[model samples]
Target: MKLRIKEVIKEQGLTVQEVATRIGKSKQSLHGIIEKGNPTIGTLSDIAKAINVPIYRLYEDDNDLSDSPVIICPNCQTQIPIETSIKIKSYNHD
Candidate 1:
């Protein structure tokens, strides 16, 4: 999975150094993790906390899946097909 660490950091108006400081990592180490393309769950969790975003926000939305509607799971960041999403409209009589 492609993690959008850099993009999310940019979106949040934060610099890599700021986030590195928040997560207790050196700027060079953080850059290495970003360039490595695969970080452990613990690392991702730490980054999420530092950036103040759900871990799912760090995932790059799959462009190939854009043709189909999908919903992201907040916990695991797995994409759920829209058809499989439970409908609540029927429960809303109002």
Candidate 2:
């Protein structure tokens, strides 16, 4: 199942309607953009402003793991990467 936007919105304790209103986008339009995972620069900026975070932070945290399998620490809100290739290959997200 896909839930990228849902997860972010949930973390912010906001609803889709609220964010859409903040960004000046219609709910249907926002839903489409979020599901496609391709937001315009203006949309990103709007979302960032609404969420009270930097534009970059709107998508990801401070961690720059690049090509690693990273997981966000639910407790500390830090991104941690599984460094070993074997570990990454064997890790089960479910």
Candidate 3:
């Protein structure tokens, strides 16, 4: 699967160095992983945790996401309409 790590990082206004520090990796190492466009499961998990986003979010393509704000039911997989707003929380990778 194509990982959107770089895009998500940019969208979150986070630098690779920030994420690298959070994940206990060097910036160069993180850049290598991003440049390769593939990371091991453990590395991906660390990145997700570092960024405070659900793992699945990294896999979602912006083009594939609908413009409408809707929540997907976990069990039945139904799309439920909901009022929502894009709120970017301050990154506290402490």
- Report the number of the highest-lDDT candidate: 1
Instruction: Rank the candidate models, highest TM-score first.
Output: 1, 3, 2
lDDT digits (tens) for residues 1-94 of candidate 3: 4668888988788999999999999999999998887677678779988888755556555445445555544454345666766988898797
| Model 1 weakest lDDT span, ten residues long | 65-74
lDDT for each candidate structure: 0.82, 0.65, 0.75
What lDDT tens digits, residue by residue, belong to model 1 across residues 1-94? 6878999999999999999999999999999999896777788889989989876677787665545666665467578776655656556566
Backbone clashes under 3 angstroms, per model: 0, 0, 0
TM-score for candidate 3, please give it: 0.62
Q: Write the per-residue lDDT of candidate 2 for residues 3-53, one digit (tens) a residue.
A: 255566777899889988988889899889888876656676677688665
TM-score of 1: 0.69
RMSD of 2: 12.7
**Global CA lDDT computed for model 1:** 0.82
